[model samples]
Target: MVRGVVRPHRVLSGSWGEVIASNLDYHRATFRWKCEGLSEAQLRRRAVPPSELTLLGLMRHLQGVERHWLQRTLAGTTPAFPPYKTYVTAAGDEWYDDSDPTPAREVYEDYVRACQESREVFARATADTARIVPNTEFGATDVRFVLEHVIEEYARHVGHADLLREAIDGSTGE
Candidate 1:
């Protein structure tokens, strides 16, 4: 498990925003906990057969996901930073493989930074009923929906990450 990842206390009773935000942060920390203390090779190793999944790959994937939702969708603007073309797969998955030569440290740092930026965005956001992507082809959705969707996304991928981490070092935990 990763050090310095403090999962926020569960909000048994609070505003809707508070509860969902806490859950999202919990899943985020769990993802990081699953990737702690691993070397570049260990992070990139394809532990599960017939799967391209890797810890570093997940980190990169989540980084894109965070940006896609909060930075693009929520902020409703293009990203100011350089894109992540070099990290994604040819099939458009936000992952890497044996051919990807990026250092593990960069991937990990990018994820942490993205998570922080997401938190900032969430903090500054308006009420849950506020419509996102108003009048767009994506249809109307609210902040609550997007936040919950991101939480669901994190939970699903964290499960994948849990399996990958276990296969990598034979270690496992919540």
Candidate 2:
């Protein structure tokens, strides 16, 4: 089982950035917890039939999500890793492939790094309001929207990870 990562306590009263960061970190840790103790094969196993989702894929996807929202969207910086969408299958329905040969350990490590980078970006920001993206489908947007969207993305995927993990080995928890 994985160790060393701990979910942070809920911030009942704090600055807006502090509360959002805490919730985001909590969900990120939850996703990692769901995949803990699994072997590479287990991590790659398509536990959810008819769906290409795997623990390793989720790790890759979340890593991209964290970087995309914080580094690209919020900070307008180029992504430091491969775009997760580039791996779209011939079927064009999934971002991850069951046949991918990348080591699961590498995927996990990259995910951790992405999370750290996102946290650093957030911590360094002077204000979320001034960092705005213009002319989006959602119109002008700022880090507030980006942070909320990223947290929502994690919350949804963590639930998926919970189901997939339970299917893999009958394991279940928050």
Candidate 1 per-residue lDDT, tens place, 74-97, comes to: 766465442444555577644444
Candidate 1: C-alpha lDDT:
0.75
Best by TM-score: 2
In model 2, where do residues sit more than 4 Å from their true spots?
A: 83-86, 89-94, 135-139
Give one digit per residue, the lDDT tens place, for model 2 in 1-174.
Answer: 376557778787899877877888889888888888899989988898898788888888898787777876776677698544445566764475546677787788889899898887777652745577753436787767767778888988999999899999999888
lDDT, candidate 1, residue 73? 79
The models' CA-based lDDT, in order, is 0.75, 0.78
TM-score of each: 0.84, 0.87
